[model samples]
Target: MKTSRQNIEIEKGHAFVTIGMFDGVHRGHMCLVNNVVKLAGDTGGISVAVTFEPHPRMLLSGGDINLRFLTSLHEKEYLLARAGLDHLLVLDFNDQLRMMSACDFVERVLVGMLGMKHLIVGYDHHFGYGGNVNSTTLDDCAGRHGFDVSRVDALVDGDVSVSSTLIRQLLEEGELGRANSLLGYEYILKGRVVEGKKIGRKMGYPTANIEPDWQFKLIPADGVYAVEVTTGENLYKAMLYIGTRPTLETGGNRVIEANLFGFDGDLYGKDLTIFFKHRIRGDMKFSSSELLSKQIAKDKDETLQLLG
Candidate 1:
């Protein structure tokens, strides 16, 4: 996919576009994006996806809010490129863009900049300041701007709607299966190996301590999880721990660590990606290091079975 940060002037009436933050690129987003691609093909126009950087919430709240994201900008770009889009335009979410009214946004960004002949959006999506603009308002703008609009219905699983918010909540609650089902893939965390206290090594279960690359990436709840670890073109079945070392006296900040079963390698400073498959158990404090070690062995056994 062709990607650009600066606006490019496209031929009038030659592009079919969709606009959203598209966090996670979950199943709900895939539904709308697939339609955009199909419509673009049918109309012989370029399929353009317009997204904002730093998330609108972060800018709107002036960095006061502790908002986390499911996908970083690079991850979002990679997923959208794999989804078969013709172009991905990343707009900077700054004060100037935020101040644009609903009508001005349509005329300036959609019509004037993108030359959008057709616009596709989610059924409940709203834009502009305060998110007061809806599909009806877009329809009015489409009529005045000489463009057409289409809204894709929400993708629902059972009674719940498939959405980024719901996925985040599920992950926080340690509901891995449902969250992965909504995402249509395993939830992933990417990071670089960092140094930690050699406590696990003494217990005969060495681990790689991970420091997430993105500061605002959403980490699931503190617990043990069955995960697939990817590093240097090799995949390993691993048990991941995300919590403070409660069994130790020096327990302080939360740490993300993983033990790769049946493998041994030096991973200091190397990058690794962990794909969460299942939640094994919640974090717990043990009476001694021996108790924690025994429990970790059980967790590893369960992880192997789950991965198999």
Candidate 2:
């Protein structure tokens, strides 16, 4: 909760800053942020992270129909704060600012606007209009702007680079183990628990349903998952489903429904966080409600075993 909105000025001092969209604040990003903090600590400087709002890709693409955010601003800020950053600057990614030249961007924004004394950027990171800016030019701009730049190498898993895109692909394909490895933690979705059709309760597997704030937030591949559910107040082991209920003839809108293992109360309208642990099985359509109920019972057993 330690954050200040006022523009910062480091008087005759050094500072560590890294720039990125920091989409999910995944493992790779944590490595960069942690390094920045470690380096800044030794120099008696602040560890600052500079991120943009409304993702740059969404802007450049004229708004993609498939565009999804991994984390909302509130989630991103919370993650960054937990990673021990001294300050976070969430800049508005407007068209005017987006059109600046690489050199101009470095001189003005990195040095003038934020007063960054030292910058840590990823090896393959690009910036400025058209993303034509590279690390070499960043160093050149740093020289002129009276700042220093260090390139953090890409974090890799085997031959694959640990990136937001790769993590998204993993989640989309239902590879929770690999995704969690790359993320350094389970992938989690946060939303407000809402009213559902009450079908689960009738079937004996009562579920708490979450309605997402953003329609375009990417959901993991449709499947059953062993999960840990959390509210701001408590955590519970649960089984979560992410998909359109094929067996129930529920069309299109993907539902995130979870059955808390051992407790129940009126949770409708409460904020819920579901942490993905493992993929149980791919979603399937059943011939009858009875058959579907049988499968769900089996899924619950498997989930409880997984949790153990």
| Candidate of highest lDDT | 1
Q: TM-scores for all candidates? A: 0.97, 0.95
Tens-digit per-residue lDDT, 1-308, candidate 1: 88899886678899899999999999999998898899999978889999999799898778954789899988888888888999999999999888888889889888999998999999898888778687678889999999999889999899988999999999998888999999999998999999989778888989999999998899999999999999979999999999988888565899999998878779999999999999999999999888898999899889889899
Winning candidate number (TM-score)? 1
Model 1 TM-score (2 dp):
0.97
Error of 2 at 247 (Å): 1.7
Query: Total clashing residue pairs per candidate?
Result: 0, 0
Model 1 C-alpha RMSD to native? 1.3
Write out the backbone clash pairs for model 1: none
Name the lDDT of candidate 1. Answer: 0.90
Per-residue lDDT tens digits for candidate 2, residues 128-188, read 8888897678878877778878888888789988999988888899888998899887887
Global lDDT of each candidate: 0.90, 0.85
